[model samples]
Target chain A: MKNFIFQNPTKLVFGKGQIEKLSELIPLDVNLLITYGGGSVTKNGVYDQVKKALKGRSYTEFWGIEPNPRVETLRRAIALGKVKEINYILAVGGGSVLDGTKLIAAGIVSDKDAWEIVLSGVAENQIPFASVMTVPATGSEMNGGAVITREETHEKFSFGGDYPQFSILDPEVTYSLSDHQIACGLADAYTHVLEQYMTTTGQSRIMDRWAEGLLLSIIEIAPKIKESPNDYELMADYMLSATLALNDFIRMGISQDWATHQIGHELTALHGITHGHSLAIVMPGTLRELKVQKHDKLLQYGERIFNITEGTEEVRVNKAIEKTEEFYRSLGLTTRLSEENVGEDTIETIARRFNDRGVAYGENRNVTGDVAREILRKCI
Target chain B: MKNFIFQNPTKLVFGKGQIEKLSELIPLDVNLLITYGGGSVTKNGVYDQVKKALKGRSYTEFWGIEPNPRVETLRRAIALGKVKEINYILAVGGGSVLDGTKLIAAGIVSDKDAWEIVLSGVAENQIPFASVMTVPATGSEMNGGAVITREETHEKFSFGGDYPQFSILDPEVTYSLSDHQIACGLADAYTHVLEQYMTTTGQSRIMDRWAEGLLLSIIEIAPKIKESPNDYELMADYMLSATLALNDFIRMGISQDWATHQIGHELTALHGITHGHSLAIVMPGTLRELKVQKHDKLLQYGERIFNITEGTEEVRVNKAIEKTEEFYRSLGLTTRLSEENVGEDTIETIARRFNDRGVAYGENRNVTGDVAREILRKCI
Candidate 1:
């Protein structure tokens, strides 16, 4: 196990009507800016609940932060935040809004351009930001990292900043979510755990079990959630699992492979695929392509997660990868690139992008530009 | 799932050589008081490492906080802290020292006596405290709860207070632990998970998995530690698991049954048995006595932890209880009252103590004085 420091101070206010805590959760004296994505919160009654909670509190509202939160859009939010002299940020919608608000929070307090912060891979200073987290994807509510896309260059990147002061996760708010959103959310969460896991085995036994426990719970609950979306317990598990996945809880003293996510972000940037669905497509390919490197963990994953113990080592690994793709397809997502009409040209573009950035991904840092092409081709 | 507000701000500096980070972790300007258990750290080299790190820092030293940390010992530390106007506490030895320091932190600030603070069940105000934990039991390093024994009354009670500002857990420090201490530590860590779990099923699937994950890691590591106690990775897992087991990460939305712990505390208070060994003796009896109430979770625990299949429902539950006792005994700890030479008189005394307090334990709050007697009788 590696020497590490772990601290996460985000107070998670979870369960039914937790948004009612919004008034007490956010300080009344701070100049607050509430950020949102589209108008889904309005239709879902989340907006009304939040407004009711923050009844007399004065706040500016910024809407239309798109999925795969765009930097171009966040720049305007930052400008508005600067002009309004906003001291606090409350992201009131899904992960995308929260992700954008992270950048806005950083940009408002620093002279650095919002895009510059993304490029630097860290937010120097961030105004305290939190979330009424409606979607269970990205884990932006509890974690310090945010992935923001630059629309002009078709690039998406993550930057580190302050974790939310608090996150209000009322699972009932997810009842009105599109089935596809739920599917993608589950996929994103599952992939997040896999990325943290699926590296070297035995680095930390507790982390492995936690990652497995999380995955097992996710896999068990995913189908049931489709059958019963409003089931409070299942969505509660989903929301909590997603937060725990990337919030440095399960990754303690272990290496992580975000290669799948790094590749998935390119898909989202270039072709505008939903973040989680892109992961659903890419993760199986990353597993299949990197089978030999991840052989032992694949066998364990196969047995523990997929119950694929009755096979040869090679067969079990292949079966694990296949079952993962099957799991994604079971979530109503296509697991192949061609099925989504994403072709070699886009794959080559992503490869060139990795090459241009001189970035190597994954736990071993071996997933260079050419290696990414191979993984993407496996998806094809 | 229950509505919950979760936040633990204790920074965990984990792995080898973490004690070197003490100077940086603790605020240098504050008046610091370093507390310790009976000199185990002196021989283990933990005290030297701490002193070396804190060479330039001015601090007062308080020693001899014995096992099950007594309010009597803590009062002296508290008095010393008050005299020195100590605003920061760094517990240098095991959980007892840390637990004692927790009380000292509370007592130094309040006009009330140390025992009065313990009797209050919650410490209203506490000076900041941190730990260089040498023991892998109790989990006092990462959590706000501390179990302190009242020497005068032979009463053991847990009180809530401020979490450690930071905890340095270097598994290397655990190498000097005696085999018995290791046994008790493993037992303590395992029972901690069971108290949080072993309640009703399906409160939160993720939490259950994480709890199970922690239990499985401990079970797998216990025997190996007996063989190779100094293995860095195994001890690291042990240290990490013990902290994670009781740190509110697993009990988020679930009802918890600490009936075993409640009974175990009585055993410790009356008999002076090691904390973890007391749990080992009490837990199986708690399971056997409350089998009907905890049937579903017992079955799940049996199947998941011990793989106790191929039996009737009653047989499986009985086997599960037996296996739990067996696991404790495997750790070289006596799991029965007669084996430890305690008789009915002690049991009755504990029962009377619970009766006097008018307290009920367990998830459903049904473990009254008479119920505790039944559980203790099962242990006999």
Candidate 2:
């Protein structure tokens, strides 16, 4: 176990109709800037619910925060926030809106550009933000991480900062989600757990079990959620699992391998692939490429999560990787680069980007540009 | 899942040498009250460490807070705090000392008697308090709940409100704990999870998985810890499991069965059994009495934690109960009322007390006094 400081102050207002409590949760005096993504909240009735909750409360609204949360749009939100003197941001859509709002929160308090804040890799001066989370992927509702895409250079990067002061997670909102969105959300959550897990074993047993637990829940709920998308209980479980997956709860005193996510983000940046779908495509490849590095933990994960205990070591590892991609497929996601029309050129471009950035990822920091190319080739 | 709003604001500074961080963690401007148990900390070097950390900080030291944390001793601490006009408290011992300090934190601000505050079941007003936790049992370091015994009446009760602002969990401090203390701590943590879990099945899958994760970790670590009592990683797992067990992190949007704890507290108040040991003795009994109500969860727990998949439903449930008692015995705690020399007379007293108070517990709220008697008889 490693020396660490852990504190997450996000007040999770969960379950049915929790958005109604939003008016009471936020303080009465702050100048509010409610941010949203492209119009899904409107179709889903989340916009109406949020408005009903904040009835008579004066606030500025910013829409058109895109998926993957580009800084190009967030800079505009920040500029508007500064003009409105917005002291509090209320993000009212999916992870993208909340992730973009995180930058706006930081940008409102500093003279730095929103993209500069994202590139700086840490934003220490953030105005407080809360969320009415309509999507369950990315865990932006509870965690301090935000992955922002740069439109100019076609790059995506993450910065860490303040968590939401509160997040209203009404699982009922998930009933209106597309099957593809639900699939991506489940994949995002599963990969989130795997990113934190799939490392060296025995660092923290509780963390391992917790990561396994989230994976099992995601796996179990995926098929059922497909059959009954409006199932309140199933959606609630999915929503909560996503928030718990990357909220620093399961990574306590443990090593994490975000190599798959780093590769996946590149896929999203270069191709405009959905963030979670890119992870589904890349994770199996990373696992196969880095199998020896993550051998023991993979074996344990195979046994615990997929019940793959009756095989030789290599057979079990291969089966575990197969089962992982199968689970993503089970969620209706395309788990291969070719299925998404991504090919050698894009893979080489991602490798070039990594090499240019001099980036090395994974638990041991050995996943260099060449290693990434091999992983991507395996996916192809 | 149930409608729920959850937030815990306690900052945990964990791992080796975190006590030295107290000076920076606590504000120097506030009047401070440093609380302690008897002289064990003095021998363990935790005292010198805390003293060294707060070398220049002017504070009042209140010592002799015994196990089970009697209100009798805490009243004196409260009076002293009032005299010194202490607005901040830094409890530098185990759960009992910190639990007692929770009351003192409440008492120093309110005009009401400390006992009255405990009886009120909620302390709305409390001066800020934090802890340098020396023991891992009871989880008072990171939670709002505090159990305080009223020694004069041989009665024990709990109150809720105001989590510690921060807690320093230096696992190195646990090395000095007695083997018996470690046994009891492990038992306490195990039962804490079962209380949150072992209730209705499927209320929250993540919560159940987290509870099961803690239980599995405790069961696996108990033997290894007996062999290497001071192993940093093992003890860190133990210390962390204890805090996570009762920190409201599990039980989110779920019903809980604290009937074991409710019954266990009676054993503590009556016979002066250590808090955790009492739970070890009573929990299996609670399971047997309530097995019909907790059937599904018990089976799931059996399969997950103990791997009782080879048996019939009844056989698995019984095996699960037997294995739970066995785990407690593995921790070197007495698991039967007969082993502890408490019998029907004490059971009757607890039943009478519960009946007189018109109290019931468990997820279904049906573990009334008579049911408690039946549960206690099972223990006998």
Docking quality (DockQ) for each candidate: 0.92, 0.91
What docking class should model 2 receive? Answer: high
Interface RMSD of 1: 0.6
- Residues B41-108 of candidate 2 have per-residue lDDT tens digits of 99999999999999987999999999999998998999999999999999989999899999999999
* TM-scores for every candidate against the unseen true structure: 0.99, 0.99
The residue pairs found clashing in candidate 1 are none
Worst 10 residues of 1 chain A by lDDT: A19-28
Per residue, candidate 1 scores C-alpha lDDT tens digits across A261-313 of 99999999988889999999999999988999999999999999988989689
Among residues 3 or more apart in sequence or in different chains, the pairs in candidate 2 whose N, CA or C atoms overlap within 3 Å are none
Task: Please tell me the interface RMSD, in Å, for model 2.
Answer: 0.6
Tens digit per residue, CA lDDT, model 1, B232-266: 99999999999998889999988999999999998
Alpha-carbon deviation at B231 in model 2, angstroms: 1.3
